[model samples]
Target: MQSLFFKIFLWFCVIVVLVGVSIETSSILANYYETRWQGVLHTIMPMEAEKCARMYETSGKQAVQNYLDDLQRQKSVRFYFFDEDGNPLLDRSAPEVVQKMALNKEGLNRIAQQNLSAVNPRQGIAMRLVPGPSGRKYNLAFQQSPTLIMPVSEAVGTHPYYRLLGIGLFGALLCFLLTRNITKPIVRLRSAASEIAAGRLKTRVAPSVRRRYDEIGALGRDFDLMAEQIEALVAAQRDLLGDVSHELRSPLARLIVALGLLRQASPEEAPEYLSRIGQEADRLDKLIGQLLTLTRIESGVESTQREKFDLTNLVQEVAADGDFEARAHAREVRVVSADACTMSGAPEILRSAIENVVRNAIRHTPAETAVELTLKQTDDPKKPGALLRVRDHGSGVPERLLSDIFVPFHRVEGGAAGNSQGAGLGLAIAERIVRMHNGSIRARNAPDGGLIVEMELPTSWA
Candidate 1:
C-alpha cells in the first residue's frame, strides 16, 4: 500500500485470484449438491419407495398411511400411491390430495407408466417435484420437504469465504515483492543524481545490465550523458579563462614598462626614450598578434595543416632568433643537433612555441654563459617524437617553485634578477601552444647547473 506499483498490482492480483476462486468455489458447490442429490435419489428415495410397496402389499392402505405419517414426523418426506387404473388408493395427510392428483393428468400418466414398465426406472430428485412417479409400483409421487434446500445454499456460501480469504492473502504477498523489485532501481538513480548535484561531476549511476529495456534504464543513460556534458563544459570554461589571462599579460606588461621609462626621462633624451618606447610598442603589437594566433589554435577555430617538416630546421630558426637577443645580453646561444628529426603540425605555431622557450632561456642566463639548445629524435615507435631541450647555466630556480614556473605570471625568486624584462608569461604561452599541437613541455633543474626546459612533439604518422 505504501508504493503505487504495489497497490496497483495488488488490486489486479486480487481481482484475478478472487474471480478464479469464485469460479472454483461455485464448481465445488455444484458438485456437492449433485452428490447430495444422488445420495437422496439412490439410497433414501429407493428405501422409501420399498417401504411404501411393502405396506401396500402386506398391511394395506391404513398401514401405508400410518407409515407415511411416521416418516413425515421423523424426516421431511411426503408419500402417496395409486392403483393400476391411476386412481389414488393411499394418500397421507388429507383427502384433498387424492382429488388434486386426479386433476393432474400428466402426473397420473407418468405414475401409470412407471408402474407399467417391466424394468424399474429411477428419477433424480429435484428442487421442485414435477408430475412424475417415485420409481415404484405402488407409490405414485413423492418429494422432500422444502427445508432440505437450505444445505446446498449453506455449502456454496461457506466455501467461497475461505477461497476469497486465501486469494486476498496471496495477492498481498505478491504485491509486496513486485513493488520492492521495481523501486530498488529508482532509489539507486536518485542517489546517483544527488551525488552529481552536489558537484561530484564524475558520479554515474551503475547500469543494471540485467534489467529490462524499460523507462528506468533510459533514465540512467540520460543521467550519465548529462553528467558528462556538465564536466566537459566546466573544464572548457576554466581553460578559456586561463588562456585569456595569459594572453593579455605580456602586452600589458610591456606597455606599463614603456610608460614607466617615459615618466623618468628628460626632453634632451626624448629621442632615445621615444626610440625605446617605439620598440616596446612594436613588442606589444607582436605579443598581441601571437596571442590571437594561440587563441584561435586553442579554441579549435583554426585547423592544423600537418605535413612532414624538418624538426632540426625549425629549432635552428628559433635558435637564430634567440641568438639575436642573446648577443645583446652577452650570452652565447648554441644549437646542437644529434639527428635529423621530423614531425607533422602547423609549422608556424610550433615555431612560435619553440622560439618562446629558446628566448626565455636566453633572457634568463648570465652574460657570456652558454645557453645550449639540443634537438634529438627517439627510436621508440610508440613514442615517435622530437625532443627539444634548452638549458641555461645561470642562477637556477628554487626547487619548491619549479612545478609552478610554467604557470602564467608565476615569477620565481631568481626570475627577478636574471629575467627582469620578462612578464613571466613566455613559458605559460609556450606550454599552451605546444599542448594545442598535441605536445608537452616541462621545466626542471639541470643536474650540473641551471634550468632545463624540454619540449616533446609526437611524430606518429599513422
Candidate 2:
C-alpha cells in the first residue's frame, strides 16, 4: 500500500473481484432457489399427471407404467397413483423424511384439499397432488439428483464460482497493465533526476515521456530546460576561469622582468626602467577593469538606466572621438552615412559598446585607411532593427575564427600582430552590451577584403 502502483492496482482488483463475487453469488442463490421451489416443480406436474391418467384410462397400466419408468430414469420424478381413499395404487418406497411428512395429517390435508405443493424437512425433495382422469388423484414428488448425480468436480466446472474466478483473474491482469502504464514514465524521470544529481547535466528523460500529453509531459520538458541551462552555466564558468588565468600571466611576467631590469640598471637609467614597470602595471590594471566590466554585465549586477536617445547622434559622437585619436597613427574614422534612429536603453553603456567597436576597427585598419561607419535604418521584416556597420581596411580575420573573434582573450592569429598594446576584451565587451539591449552582433570579412562588424539594436525591448 505504501507504493502507488500497489495501492491503485490492489484497490481496483479488489473492487472488480467483489463485484464479480457479488453477481455470481446472487446468480447461484437464484438458481438454487429456482430448482428447490415446490411451485416450480408443481407447475409442470399437473400436465404430466393428466397425460399419464389419460393413457391409463384408454389403454392398460403398461402404457402409463412405461412413461413413469422413463420419467424416473430421466428426470428423477416419482409418481404415486391413488383413489379417493389414501391407498397408493403403484407400490413405491417413499423417502423417510417424506414418509414422516405424510404422517402429519394436517399437512396432508393442506396439500390434498387445497391442492398445494410442499417440501419435507430434507432439501432437494418436493411433493404435489394433481387430479387425474376419471376423478383419480395422483401424488407427484420430485427429488433433485436423488440416486444418480454428477461428480462434484465435474459439476463445479459449470458453477458460478468458476465464472467468478475467471472474472477476478481478468480484472487482476487489467489492473496490473493500468498500473504499469501510469508509473513507467514516473520511474524514468526519477532515474534521469538521479543521473543529473550525480553531475551528469546532460541527462534527460526519454522522448516517450516528453511526448506525453499530460502533466507528466510538462514536468519532463521543464526538467530538460533546467538541465540545458545548468550545462551552459557550467561551461561558461570553465571558460571564464581559463581566460582569466591566461590573460593575467603575460602582464605578471612582464612586471617581473621590469623589476629585474630596474635592479640591475645603473642609477642614471632608473627612469627608463621605472617607465617600463609602470606600463606593465597599467596593462594589468586595464585587463582587470575589462574583466570586471564583462563580469558585471554577464552577471546582471549592473543595473541599466534605460532612456530614449538618438542612436545617430551617439554614433557620430563616438566616430568623432575615434577620428581624433586615430590621427596619431595616420588612421581616420568617419561615418559614411547616418539616419536618425532612436532606441530605449542605457545610453552610457551603448556609448561604451559602440566606442569599443569603432576603436578596435581604427586600431586594426592600416595607416591612411579610414575606418568607415554606416548607420542604416532597416525595415526588413526579418531584422526590423537598426544596423550599425564598422569596416576596417586590414587583414580580415580567418574564416574559421570569425565567430570566436568576440570571445574574451580570443584574438585572430595576425589581425593585430604589428600592434600588441591593447588587450583583447574590446569586442567581447561590445557583444555583452549589445546582448543586454536585446540586440545581436556579428563579424564577417567584407566584400572588399576588410573586417566588418555589424551591431543590430532593437527599437522596442519587447
Candidate 3:
C-alpha cells in the first residue's frame, strides 16, 4: 500500500503543474498575437485611398501589391481593390475566395458601405478606398492583419508535442523520486510496527531524518513516543503481576501445608479442615487465573477471533452452569429468550462474560428470589445487536456503587456482605472481554426492583 504523504505530494505536484502549464500556454498565445498585430501595424500605412488617388499620377496597385506580398511572406495576408461601382478591379486573395466574392453581391455592397477608412477594429481586415484618375473611378484597398491570419496549428508544428512529452516524462520521474523519499520513512515505520506486533516490544522508527522538519520527521517523532509509552506500560504491568503473584504464593502454600498437618493430627477434624483448605485453594486459583486473563487481554497477547454464533445457545449454556449455584441459594435461574439471537466474537470469551453476569446475579439475590437471564435482539434492522441481560430480584446495588461495579477488585459494600467467595474480578473481566469484541457492558438497577447487568454485542447477521 502507498503511504498517505506520498499520495498527498503527488496530487499537490499534479495540480501545480496543470495550473502552471495552463497559465503559461495562455500567456504565450496572447503575447504571440499581440506582437504580430504590432508588427503588421508598423509595416502598413493607414491613409484614405481617395487622398492617395488625388496625389498619384500613376496606378498605386503595384506598390500596394508589393506591400501585401511582403506581409504574406512573413505570415498570411489577403488584399483586394474595388471601383466606385463595387466591382473588384484588383484581387490578390486565394483563387477560391476570389471566385466566392465575385458571385456575392451582398458582400460587395457591405464592402462599398465599409468604404476605405471605415473598418471594424476588432476584425483582422482593414480597408481604404480612394478616387482613381477620374472622379467617377475609385480604388478600394483591402489588407488583412498578419496576427489574425497566422494559424496556431501550423505555427506549433511538432515542437510543442515533443516539449510536452519531455515535460510529462520528467514529471513522472520527479514523482517517483519524491514518492521514494517520502515513503522511505513510512516503510521503516511499517516494518517497526510489524516487528512490534510480532512480539518485539523494543522495535521503533528511527529519528535520523529529524533535521528535515517535514511531515515524515513529525511522524518519526510520534512513532518513537508511542513505542516508548507502550514499552513502559508493558514493563510496568509485568513487574506488578510478578510482585502480586509472588506475594500471594507464600500464604497459599502455607495454608495448604497447615491443612495437611491438621489432617494428620486428627482424623475426625480432617473433613472440615480439608473442605476449608479446598475453598481457600479454589479462591487462590480463581484469583491467579483472573489476573493472568486480565494481563493477557490488557497486554494484547490475546485477540478475539470474532465470528457469528447463536447468542441463544451461549446464554442457555452459561445459565445452565450457574443453575446449581442459584439452587444452592434457594433462588431460581431462568433463561428466557423471546427470539433467537446471533452475535459475533470469541465464543469462549463471550460465554465466560455471560456466565460471570449470571453468577453475579445468583450470588446477590435473596433466597426464593428469581434470577432472570434474558436474551433480546434489537428491533432496528440497521442496528443489529444482541443484548444479554441478567437481572436479580434482590436488594439491588446502590446508585453510588453502580458505576464502579465493572471496575477490577471493586466489590459493593452491601452486595458482597454475605458472599466472600469471589475476589470481585468477574465483572471487570467480563467488561474487558466484551470490549475486546467491540461490545459494551453496563450495570443498572431495574425499575421493577433488581440489578440488571446488560451486555450488547454487535452482529453482522441480525
Per-candidate count of clashing residue pairs (backbone under 3 Å)? 0, 0, 4
lDDT score, residue 138, model 2?
Answer: 52
TM-score of each: 0.50, 0.67, 0.50
Judging by TM-score against the true structure, name the best candidate.
Answer: 2
Residue-level lDDT for 157 in candidate 1: 51
**Model 1 misplaced stretches (Cα beyond 4 Å):** 1-280, 416-418, 460-462
lDDT of each: 0.66, 0.76, 0.67
Candidate 2 RMSD to the correct structure: 8.7
How do the residues 286-339 of candidate 1 rate in per-residue lDDT, one tens digit apiece?
A: 656655665676677554566678777778877887888789878878886646
Residue-level lDDT for 216 in candidate 2: 74
Task: State the lDDT of candidate 3 residue by residue for 61-118, as single tens digits.
Answer: 6665565556557755565655545465544443444334444545545655654243
Model 2: lDDT equals: 0.76
The TM-score, computed over Cα atoms with residue i paired to residue i, of candidate 3 is 0.50
Total colliding residue pairs, candidate 3: 4
